[model samples]
Target: MDPRARPFRSVLYIPGSKERALEKAKTLPVDAIIFDLEDAVAVEEKPAARSLLTETLKAGGYGPRFKIVRVNGLDTEWGRKDVQAMAFAGADAVLLPKVEKTAQLDELSEMLPGMPLWAMMETPRGILNADALAAHPRLEGFVMGTNDLAKELGCRFRPDRLAMMSSLTHCLLAARAHGVVAVDGVYNAFKDEEGLMAECEQGRDLGFDGKTLIHPAQVPTANAAFAPSEEEIDLARRQIAAFEEAEKNGQGVAVVDGRIVENLHIVTARETLAKAAAIAQLEAST
Candidate 1:
């Protein structure tokens, strides 16, 4: 599937070992579900988790939500099995954790021919190699690993994430340069609704395509944060109409609501409309 076609405002991570969570996720409103066989699962449970994910994908009633398998990093023993299982299970993508270099991605690309790879950029090494990793042909996107990054840098959470903004933006720039989706890390405090919403807003403003969610409760907030506002949709429509009219009149640019509108503005408007349409369709089907 074309990763760019989907609206991934909230990608929820469900522990692969938890049968209840996996079952419940089928009905959640999130754009995608990452069946985590990595940090969320214990070492002893890795084998079982892999089996469970394989069976779950085979059963196949996940509706419109995109399915991804978060495999353990290639550095571990379980990582190779995770890739083999996920690839044969017919998952939409395989999320590679703790990826520090493009060579690691190249190795996985050879193993899983057609499956897209979403690399985790959580370590200092990963962040430093962000550009090269993003430029990799098989790398479809990056998921920021904020918790590990904070630990590695000895940074404190000031509630605003002021210290990690540079790293966050750097990843964003890299993803944008390569036309790849960049997903923000999860907020650990699932019960804090206000804090979650604030962080979701912060991620959106920082140009993240979506936020990785830890709980089902955070899904609505994440969806709302990344969705275009009514005002934005209205303006997009106006700009599109103005541009079309200008083209009819043989003009290169048009004025919309006192601002100059050009071909680029129309392109943005089209994307906004497409996203809104996709969201509406998803909601209607649910």
Candidate 2:
């Protein structure tokens, strides 16, 4: 993955067992769809869900939409099969739930030679070994599973999520250190649009590349929150122009909007412009 490229800001979860939901999701504007075979599927439905997800991938038309399969953990009976099917499905990535060690990643790397592995940092052990897990060569990214983390830690789900903020930040830091994208977990209250926006902003502020969403209603909010606004884009353009002009004049830095603009600022501005352009292209295509 390109380090400068913006990731899926809104990764919608679609139950692998629900054919209707899966089909509908393919037409949505979500950057990625996580076809879930773990918690979303009932014990008896796992096999069917696996088959459906496999077939859906084979019948491709999801245009620019990234596909990821959330498989059962390695400890489960269906886990091995899920890995085998996903490996052959040619998915963009495989989401491994409850990953707690680099050894698990090693096993997955052996199974799927070149496919990216997205680890869910939800369990206590997973969080503890986050740095090591992130260092794995096949590790592409991580999805913060706040709900499970809260339950495992015996912490209450407060509106502010103060209890988990530190842990969440740590995860982001580890991912950044390893040059991997880190996404914030889903905001459960699908009806609370205001609350969802606030959380989305908070996640962006905390350095998350994007967020996992549980519903389609949250897509616009996630996109807006993670996208570069008009004002930001204009500022970035101005900064880039100023720095380029300074270089032309044999100057090391330039003043932009009464503030000094340096090489670092220009780099950031270029990245911001790239993100804005990527988002614009994505919107235009949809």
Candidate 3:
């Protein structure tokens, strides 16, 4: 599938130290997996975890799910080693934590040429520098680290995410402007199914490609929420049909849902179908 057309509905984070979770991921319905080597792994276990992920990735049974390795920042003791190991780990992309500047990406790209990098928008400076970071040629996407953002901002965590709205919107604009994928932050309350679904819906409504997942239970909801709904697909089909029929008579617009649908609307309508088709193709491939 074209990388642009691929869905990022459920980008689940699995701890690299957990062997069982890594194996179980092969059967999950997630669209992507972030093998966490930073926050998720302990200090003593980093070496073993790194070696394990490297070996597992080389062995290869992840199926169609996208595999990404989240590495520590270059300033840390194990950061460079993590990057070196992941350079040949066969993972799809390498995720960098607390990316605050464009130069940081340039440096990482220099270290691992030809490898795609994903940035974690967690710090205040990083959110402010979103434009430059998203504009990088090798950046595949932005993963909102809301947990870190909330901690850094010292703000309350509300279901509406009122405190982080500005930062979220900033990152979203940057990602969309550069045509790079933007995934919403993870919901910390892993057991709150209702909250997770609500947040996924909110993210989808806010133009995010998907929401990050901390657990397997969140996968189905994220996938369903991010994809186009049946009603939306039907409306898109009708809009295209109506618009094409109107154009045959030299008209430039059609009416649907009691509103005017112009040629520009056709572009969106066709894109909706295309997104749905791409998702179906992904499911078929899996």
Candidate 4:
């Protein structure tokens, strides 16, 4: 499947060190799994985590859900070893934490050649250099590390995420510009369904392809938030029909729901339908 066509509605992070978590993840409804060997593992568990995750991936029960391994930064003691282990571990991509520039991606690409790479767009430097990072040919996506970004910025948490808007938008713009999948940061309150839904909606509104989840409970909310709704699907069909009719009539635009439907609108409408179809297919298969 094309990376852009695949559903990323819910991306869950599972600790690579936890065998139980890895096993349970195969049954979840999430669209992607971040088999985390970075912050989620203890210093002493890093090596074990890497080895276990490698074998687990090689075992191959993940199905069509995209599997990405979040490796520790190259500066860390475990980073190089993590990269080497996951290079041929059957992962779809390997994510680098605290990515600040293309050079970091370059080094990772050389170490793990022919694999897709993703970045943790967290630090101030990373946000400022979002465009540069997104431009890397090997980079496939960006996973926002909101917790780390908040700590680095020393900003208070807000439901509106007012302080983080500029950073989020900056990274999002870069992702869209470069055709990289952009996933929103995780919502930490696992038990708060209402809160998780709100953040998922917010992330979707901000043009995120999906939201990273900390818990399995958060998957449904994120999936529903990011997937195209019935109303949207209906409108997309209508817009396409109207635009096609207009084209047959040699008209430059058509009217749908008292709004102008042009070529650009048709482009968006087709994408909406395509995404909806992709989601349906993925759900059926998994």
By TM-score, is 3 or 4 better? 4
Best by lDDT: 4
Model 3: what TM-score? 0.98
Better of 2 and 3 by lDDT: 3
- Candidate number achieving the greatest TM-score relative to the actual structure: 4
lDDT per residue (tens digit) for residues 1-286 in model 3: 2355788989999999999999999999889999999999999999999999999999999888999899989999999999999999899999999999988899899999999899999999999999999999999889999999999999998889999999999999999988888999998888998998999999999999998999998898899999999999999999999999999999988898899999899998998999999888888877
Of 3 and 4, the candidate ranking higher by lDDT? 4
Candidate 4: misplaced stretches above 4 Å? none
Predicted structure 1: lDDT: 0.90
Give the C-alpha miss distance for residue 236 in model 2, angstroms. Answer: 0.3
Which whole-number lDDT from 0 to 100 does residue 254 have in model 4?
100
Each candidate: RMSD: 1.5, 1.2, 1.1, 0.9
Each model's C-alpha lDDT?
Answer: 0.90, 0.89, 0.92, 0.94
lDDT of 2 at 203: 94
Error of 1 at 9 (Å): 0.5
* lDDT of candidate 1 over 99-174, digit per residue (tens): 9988899999999998888988889889989999999988888898899999998999978999899889999999
After superposition of all CA atoms, the RMSD between model 4 and the true structure is 0.9
For 242-282, candidate 4 gives per-residue lDDT tens digits of 99999999999999989999999999999999999999999
Candidates sorted on lDDT, descending: 4, 3, 1, 2
